[model samples]
Target: MDDVDETPDSVLAARARTGDAAAFGALVVRHQPAAIRLATIVGGSLDDAADIVQEAFVKAYRALPQQRDLVSATPLDPEAVALATTDAQLLIAALARLGERDRQVIGFRYFAGLTEAETATALDAAAGTVKSRTARALARLRQELDRSGVRGD
Candidate 1:
């Protein structure tokens, strides 16, 4: 019989979930640069950007099973992926303009794929507070990106 085929992301994710540091390291090698580019666009410096990206990926990995569950429960479609990618980019750009607290909120909510409740838990803030902060931070980032002529996709 032929070996079962698996997509690279699925394989990597599985390996990562199983605590294979090397597999996770490979995943980082594959995706970290894109994450860093996004973080730099949001965090304003190479060092800060790298840090943010690293944090985001760590958070992403921690939340991956939940994210997959949510996705599976909903729908797996191109539109969803496209929307998520756009939102991620927008949030990254916005995070770059924010202070530490605001950045943490956005990173946890958007990149980490956390719900408001989950975000509140992680941040030790009220859900309402997380929601408001996310909204305000996003609005400010939108304004800043617009002023900078970085059109949102």
Candidate 2:
């Protein structure tokens, strides 16, 4: 443990990657002050900066093994774009005829991209209710779209 502080960051990082607790602690101790300082310069307060730094550290630690993998910066898939463009226009037209709650359910399910549980939380209903309501909303939307003759172009 003597002169452990003299270890280079690269060595510490390597050790940390291998699950060396002491080495990771050393790396954190060495880098955290700078991270906090940078966060503070951007975030405008000590409390906020500390919170940001802590979250960054946690995320960084969790992602350490996958750091070398390249991530897609733009997540909008072309297939999704094509489908949404063709069907969404007709769907939007149908949505306009539904009641407010039905519209909200559809919006939460599709446009807002909320999961059933999340939609339930947003609507303050049970998850099962959200699922059933979503089914009913889709059926209503289908009838509305059929009656309006809003075919996907």
Candidate 1 regions with alpha-carbon error over 4 angstroms: 1-25, 33-94
Over the stretch 1-153, how does candidate 1's per-residue lDDT look in tens digits? 022233355666676666666666677877888877765554346897687678777776776555542213333578888977876666565556678776667767776578999989978889999999999877877787776556676
Going through the candidates in the order shown, the clash numbers are: 1, 0
Which ten contiguous residues of candidate 1 have the minimum total lDDT?
1-10
Model 2 lDDT tens row, 1-153: 446789866677776776677877787788889666644443346796587677777776876776663333455677997977767556655676677678767766775457999989978999999999889988898898888665534
Candidates in order: C-alpha RMSD to true structure: 7.0, 14.1
lDDT for position 92 in model 1: 61
| TM of each candidate vs. truth | 0.49, 0.43
Top lDDT: which candidate number? 2
- For TM-score, the strongest prediction is 1
Query: How well does model 2 score by local distance difference test?
Result: 0.72
- Which pairs clash inside model 2? none
lDDT of 1 at 121: 97
